[model samples]
Target chain A: MTPQAQRDILKKHGLKVTAQRLAILDYLITHETHPTAEMIHQDLPMISLATIYNTLERLVAAEIIIVIDSLSDGKRHFDYYGQPHYHIVNTQTNAIIDAENFDVAPLLAAARQASGLNITGFHIEVYGVNPEDAR
Target chain B: MTPQAQRDILKKHGLKVTAQRLAILDYLITHETHPTAEMIHQDLPMISLATIYNTLERLVAAEIIIVIDSLSDGKRHFDYYGQPHYHIVNTQTNAIIDAENFDVAPLLAAARQASGLNITGFHIEVYGVNPEDAR
Candidate 1:
């Protein structure tokens, strides 16, 4: 998305539009790779780690982004919540790849029946190793 | 499971069988609520929080229990890994319910094809609200 679009999203979410927030949001939108605050800081060296963390917290609170802790690595990974999709985490490389082929409606239905809860949504993390890494 | 069984399992995992470890493992086996260290300490008040944390870390390291961080509560919940199953996290109550009806083999296959990863296992957390809480 364009910088203006990112700024508008921030404004819509009642977050103050700032250069740092715009950069972070733009980066997540452009790069589907789930990144931790430290990784984001490494890429956007101009932004302080504290600022990146603060911005990420605000974005998460606004529901414009989501925090994923399902990885083997203990760090919190951030993903843009613009679209609905599942994640495939590489256990060997600790990479988060987006997988959108399978439908989760049936699984959600089963969960609703099994748990007797009004299912809202779901998060599925498939753990595996790359073919070459498996050997 | 009996205390002896728990002890044997711990020994099989190369973990020293201790009274505290036995108690914690038995508690987890009896209660599938996916409790955090604080919750475990609340029930096993005789055990120090530090000890509970230490034992939990050891159990997790031994692969006797799995840690779940998918809940909205932001607490790492522990579950005995006696059997493979999925989790249904009640977003409102933050309760982790075991869901076993749905088979995830197809989903894993799709993820493997989609991401080109040699599929090993998967973790699914279906978020929802309880029936009464939903109304």
Candidate 2:
């Protein structure tokens, strides 16, 4: 996404556009590798780790991004919430592959019926290993 | 479970049957709340936070327990891996309700086909709010 587009998103979410926020949003938009805060900092060394964390927190609160902490590595991975989708996590490498094929609407409905609660959101992560790596 | 029974399970899992380990396991088995380390520490005041964390980590590594980080609260909750089941998270209260009625085998299979990876395990969390609380 262009820097202007990033700024627009930040503004749309009522977040003030800053260089740090734009850099992080741009990185997440450009990279699909669901990265941790530290990973994002490594790529954008100009931004301090604390700044990256604060900016990410704001974006997440504004619903501009989502956090995934279900991976085996026990690290929080952030993904741009452009659309709703599930994730496929590699158990060994901690790599995240977005899997939008599987629809979770049916399962969400089932959970609501079973629990009798007003459903809000859902998180589904399928853990797997590459066949080549397993071999 | 009785103390001896907990000890037996620990031994079976090749873990040493220490008092701290048994206490944590017993607490989890008795309480289905899926508590964080701090919550567990609150219940078992004698056990230090460090020991609770260490024991929980060891039990999770041994497959005797599982760590859930998918809740909106962003705290790691521990559950006994006695059987495979999903969780219903109360977004407002952070309470975890076990929902065993939903079968995820079909979903996992679909993810395997879509990603072409050797599926290992899966984590599913349905977020919701209790109707009474919602009202």
Residue by residue across B1-135, what tens digits does model 2's lDDT show? 678888999999899888898889999999988889999999999999999999998998887888888666768989998888888888777878887887788888888988889987778888888778754
lDDT of 1 by residue, A1-135 (tens): 677888899999899988888899998898877889999999999999999999999998787888899776778899998877888888787888887899898999999999888987778888778788744
Off by over 4 Å in 1: A11-16, A45-51, A131-135, B45-51, B130-135
Q: How would you encode candidate 2's per-residue C-alpha lDDT over A1-135 as one tens digit per residue?
A: 567888899999888878888889999998998999999999999999999999989988787888898776668889998888888888778878887787788888889988889987778888888899753
> Where does candidate 1 chain A have its weakest 10-residue lDDT segment?
A126-135
Off by over 4 Å in 2: A2-4, A72-74, A132-135, B1-5, B71-74, B130-135
How far out, in Å, is residue B117 in model 2? 2.3
Q: Estimate the Cα RMSD of every predicted model relative to the unseen true structure.
A: 2.8, 2.7
Clashing pairs in 1: none
What TM-score do all the candidates reach, one by one?
Answer: 0.85, 0.87
- Most DockQ-accurate candidate: 1
